[model samples]
Target: MSPGDEHDYRGKDQGGRPDDPYSTLGGTRQTRTRLPDGDAGLPHARRPVRNSRSLVTITGVVVLLIAAIAFANRGGGSDEDAAAPGAEKPGTTGSAPTAATGTKPVQGKNGTIASGFAHDEQGAQSAAANYAVALGSAEMFMKESRHQILDTVYSPAAANKLRAPQDLAYSAEFLARLGLDSDGNAPQGSTFISRTVPVGTKVLAFDDDTAKVAVWYTGLIGMSGQDSTKPVSTTWKTWTAQLSWLGGDWKVTEASEADGPAPVPGDVAASRSDAISKAVEEYGGFTYAR
Candidate 1:
């Protein structure tokens, strides 16, 4: 055996390290010869001591395997690591802003689609964010502008599906329910606001052409007026979109949303309609970048 190879031995000498200490001395000394216990020299003999060693060796191997598995399952917080076995860990990549820093929206031509994502995971997320913003904007609530926005953002197939529903969704009845006039315009002294504020978007999975992104967002709903039935309020939702890269930009093939995915409430109280209106007029949307 090599020097580094470890084997279990029984009995102890004077010094702690194994091996016979006096073997180096030239002179030979007589020592008592103990009888072999249970056929010690027989090749096929089974002994309790051998069984104990085997158990120890097996235990050591099992311990090493467990440790290795634990290390493999640990989250390194990067997108590129392979996970260890038997680890109930999340995917190698997640949707938090830290992991998505590289996925900020890029600027494309104005009057044209302006998503900055390459045809990759980041691109899919960027597309979803922008689409969510567009889908939940005041433009979608307006009859004339609604059609234009939907046509631009969704794929032809999706546009067909959304057009009928979107038309019905923004109808005179729906508009009246929000305290707006038949044309979907709010009364004087009332500010009409519909908006989606995206917190972050996570890419669940993707390929070269198609991708799925989940966007967590807060939306402002209702009309801004004291007497208005629909008072401006906030809603939390998750928007999932199937996207495809089209004409150098990402467009929605199909999309849907579910309520909540809400984060815990902060100490701050909700803002009033007046404050919300002022903020909307003051702040303008910008082209996002990764």
Candidate 2:
């Protein structure tokens, strides 16, 4: 039970079909989520309706992988063993990738998400990591929170640009398949979890006005309930965000994701759906910073 070992972040994309690398974040399987009638302008996935169930239900088989993401970046262990917190395992490598710099995570909040980052490489990476969390979160599946996510993470122009498409991606039809209501609420007695946790960040490209940051992350997504057909699962992804120093903070201009450089799965047996559901309620998420 490491810091976030039971609460990884699973994913889904706003654009593209289930076959698209970025599209299927819950797992590798393809779900044909058809575009609603008269929405031909949308990039809706079309697969024959099967057994009167939603297609995205068959999308991916998630693996549960909870690893510390934001806490690893807060950096307070300036002790002698500072360089190797991950050495708890027999052959584990030093935690340089998740190494913290004693830098405090941003305290500023933008509607439950961190904001007000510094205008530097560190700030850019922090923003990207936190933004990735917001994008892949359960909130992102809900209309209101999804709007807030875009507005908080992206620039006005970028948010506006992505709004309609994002809404389409999480439409009622899609939610119905995932066993959620039109408002993204899970069925009674069930808990729906969609979260993203960044394991590390990299500055792929940077400039005075803009920066490109890549966040290596894992996500947990699915319904945790006794009768849940879609049990909680995991996905590994690299979310690359293009940020601009706008409004005195790093804002996202664009973002895209790619499938993993995922590690081999460990031998831990999967948790019961009830355990996952309870964990979702008990474990609070974090504000990622670097």
Candidate 3:
């Protein structure tokens, strides 16, 4: 087995739904609690009835009153006041600030992966997050590219230890399950999608020669085609890397993963396989920076 044959960062089955590699990490899964409503298998007691016509009249009046109040509030403020500087904006939800340090995102590239990050805390975080994306990418599924990526991102010692195991994990059986050829290429007319998007990064620890950073990210993986059984889906995870400033660059010394601070799933309808394939082909990824 070669480094290119490795399954993924998570060394688990990559068949239909790839298993969460960070499950063994110390975070526990949270479940929502359901509260029982008013009556529990009890028969309802009958009550005296009021005039149905009167009840309808009262409900209609209440609704109209609420609507009138809402309209009044909408018209309460003056246009100048609404347009004033520093005025609070309506329908604006809070979000984290942009992950920019004003430094160039990358100084150079080692093959297709970004390299030569800044030497400060922000640069270390940026390097770790981008490295996570590369390690989790579809390119890592192939032999030659995987070797290049491992060599680029990981410390020489760490890469040596991981290469053989990774190769074994991405064996022929695993590739078959993911509808890919032994070389990790998808079939003709099929698209294999694997991408990692870092939401944010936290510098857990930092120093002159070493730093630790955790990247909160979301990933998309699977195959897309007319007959694909393993349609692409999204997963949320957090990756922590212990990085060493080696060869004048931050390189991964060790890494681990954990379940995410995931957002609640939304109600967007799933797209058709063909549409998904087309979108994957049309959209290109970015050179992420912090």
**lDDT of every model, 2 decimals:** 0.69, 0.77, 0.77
Quick one: ranking by lDDT, best first?
3, 2, 1
Q: Tens-digit lDDT track for model 2 on 59-118?
A: 333322222434355345543444455444211234355655434557599888898886
Candidate 2 regions exceeding 4 Å error are 1-97
Model 3 spans > 4 angstroms off: 1-99
Cα lDDT tens digits for candidate 3, 48-95? 233444544554565466556555555335444534376433212231
lDDT score, residue 97, model 2?
54
* lDDT for 105 (candidate 2): 55
Note each model's CA RMSD in angstroms: 15.1, 29.6, 24.6
Q: What lDDT tens digits, residue by residue, belong to model 1 across residues 1-290?
A: 11222533322332234333333223123343455786677775532222244444555675466556656555434433443354323323533454434333565643434554666777677777777887788877787777777777887778878888888877888788888888878899888888888888777768878888899989888888767777887899999998888877788888778999787878888687788789888998755433
Clashing pairs in 1: 72-84, 103-290, 104-289, 104-290, 105-288, 105-289, 106-116
TM-score (all chains, Cα) for each model: 0.63, 0.66, 0.66
Give model 2's TM-score versus the native structure. Answer: 0.66
lDDT of 1 at 89: 35
Report the number of clashing residue pairs per model.
7, 13, 3
